[model samples]
Target: MDLDAFVSAHYGEWEHLRALSSRRTLSGAGADELLDLYQRAATHLSLLRSAAPDPAVLQYLSTVLAKARTASLRRRTLSWSRVADFVVRDLPAVLYRTRWWWIGTALVNVVVAVLLGTWVARNPSVQTSFISPAAAQQLVNHDFSNYYSQYGGADFATHVWTNNVWVAALCIAFGVLGFPIAYVLWNNVVNVGVQGGIMVAYGHGSEFFGLILPHGILELTAVFVAAGSGLRLFWSWVEPGARTRADAMAHEGRSMVVVVLGLIGVLLVSGAIEAFVTPSGLPTFARVGIGVLAELAFLAYVFVLGRRAVREGFTGDVVAEDRSATRPTAA
Candidate 1:
């Protein structure tokens, strides 16, 4: 392995790789040539490392190869156009298809929350158990309402978004394990119900609704969606139907990822309402109305756009091209 001779023979190939990598644009032929040159250069580098290696020569080849790899990956990266396509076509379709899973979760949670709140409000003992009489009175009198206005609007919005997103993410991440999803939903529902009961018991029921509903409706819906998606993922493995267990889980996992990303955006809207609108000087009707409108808009997106997408044969799964090839096996 004569290092000088080796460099002399492969230097041109390395230079070609470097030139192509440095180019701002490449034609089809030029791109093919660049790839070919890159492969050859990589081989040369490997040979240099394994055979008679010179520090300077090896350094040069390595640098050129690195640049070529970067350029190749940049060309393959997703463009803004692909992002738009996913948002318009893929995301809503999956949400629509999985609506049943999360919708039921939402209804059950709502019922439990209302019942718990009523029970707690009607029982002084339960209310006292949740919080001291003094603290409960304080929350009912001031703290509950004060929370909305304590921070600046923008800061509050960011804090609320982050916290809600964390909860939503936990629901999805733990939903697969079955019990965790139930636990998370139970904790959230009880917390809401308990707070409502405390407020109502103290004679600020209107204030509680006014403060909570503006953000709670959408925020809780997002959490329920995550929980539902998680439960569906668990079911995919439990009752895999005709597909292999692995295949069913893979499909549901990918679709749930889409739901998680979409919920980030949804939680952002709810956070903004909680921070800015809920605490604003608007009347209770108008504030609650805005929240209702936002909730309805999300439902429309899931049902209208999602249903249409499903009817067009979208299942919220990745395109066949992107999924693993199915291997043939003995029946």
Candidate 2:
């Protein structure tokens, strides 16, 4: 049959398959039938392409193919809706499985911060070069100390919450731009380093802990998590793995989103503490203890509760049976 004739004859069946694919669960037989039909259609198209028919016939075939492709894509999008649920549900499981990666990234950030601190201690002038004179002067003049003292006020807490949320959102959003994630990570790492250096420079290394540790640990840890999520998102686009780039990206995007959400949660809590608790003239040990408890709680949620919730949501039963035995195995 001619390409146009073949397509016209099968068009209704194609539409039916397309519709079936949109449903949440397709029976094995239904999936098989759809695949069989697709293969037949593909064979016909291949034959038509090889024939190099008249321009009019080619044009008609092209239109039909385009329509079929569009219908197929629509169905795939619908199918992805089901897959997306699994993605969201299994996110904590995925992150737990990849804990080493997250830990490594955070350790790197901390190490870099320490190294920067050491470098600044050795060469005090480098601080002036890195930060503006006005900013450096402010740091030297205990402006941060004053700011933290007033930080726990209602207005200051609101401001900190708003600003930190913006930063967390930007880290996740810019990750979609591929290369920009690198810049985001670099900026965050350097900021941490500078903060560490400034604390040591002011001879308030211990006092700095009292002022910063209450919120800094959680806030900084969240930043690392944000950076890791960005990296995962970028890797999805650049997929160096076995899967195609598009497939890899779709898979990674799901897990990355969970990480981002978790980071946002951490940021919110950290911002509240930074604004309200840090400025309360709390003792160093009290701040450190609070910070440790908060950090431990976050870890528990991320690694334990989150993981269990995901597994419970997505896990399916496996049924096994011996064909020769007349009894079925309980799932």
Candidate 3:
């Protein structure tokens, strides 16, 4: 290969590519042109490396390729509008669609906790079996309340956020298996029941309810949402309805991802409450009122925004172009 001749032939194209990459905005046609030009320059680089091996030319070509790569990535990166659409439409739609699953899970958890808590509180033997009477008194008198205020507000909020997020994530991640969701919820039920039972047994039931309700309302709701998402994913494969099993599972799985993102925000609010509001010197009514308001805000956001999105033919899955292709075997 004549290195000089080859350079002369592609030099104009290289300059054009550089110009395109430097542009402030790229239209579809310009983007297409830039991509084609980039590919051609890459080929030219390969030829030069193999035949001529000119270091200056290779270095120049490498710079152009890097710039082009950056430009391509810049074009594909998420814009504010895309983010707005996701927040306004995608998150809520999926949450709305999955509402029944989480709501049902929440109800069952609550019923179990209430019944078991009642049993534990009423029975002296059960309370003693769970914890020494002295320990139970300590928890009732100090430990339970102290747990919320042990750290500064910001540190406690972060700790609570990370822990709750992990629990919610596990519920979604293990949703397909089905059994883990049961285990997590059951574990949660037992903990709440035992704690409540012990507190009541020690004549401090009011304190337990007062401390928990502020954060627990939203915190447990988020957990239920996660558990529900997992159950929905499990059922997608089990029944699959009119869709093929793979297609159903894929569709529901994408929807579950939306729930995960939305729940992160939900848990953060709850964590904030648990850290600052629940433990703060505010009156009990004021603290619980803040929690109730937070819970209502989340419910309204999901039902209003999510329901509207669902009504507009958005099922909380990725847009049509982004979805995996269904096989001909799909029912």
Give the poorly placed runs of model 3, Cα more than 4 Å off.
Answer: 1-11, 20-36, 47-60, 67-75, 329-331
Q: Give the per-residue lDDT digits (tens) of candidate 3, residues 214-293.
A: 99999999999999999999999999888898999999999888888888888999999999899888998999899899
- Sorted on TM-score, best first, the list reads 3, 1, 2
Clashing pairs in 2: 152-275, 152-276
List TM-score per model, in order. Answer: 0.82, 0.62, 0.88
Clashes per candidate (backbone, < 3 Å): 0, 2, 1
Whole-model Cα lDDT of every candidate shown, in order: 0.88, 0.65, 0.91
Cα lDDT of model 1 overall? 0.88
Candidate topping TM-score: 3
Ranking by lDDT: 3, 1, 2
lDDT of 1 by residue, 158-251 (tens): 9999999999889888867888889889999989999999888888999999999998899999998989899989999999777787888898
Clashing pairs in 3: 92-306
User: In model 3, what is the error at residue 33, expressed in angstroms?
Assistant: 4.8
Query: How much is the lDDT of residue 154 in candidate 1?
Result: 97
lDDT of 2 by residue, 45-105 (tens): 5776777455665565455555455544444443676455434444456556556655777
Instruction: Give the distance in Å from residue 255's predicted Cα in candidate 3 to where it truly belongs.
Output: 1.4
State the weakest 10-residue window (summed lDDT) of model 3: 322-331
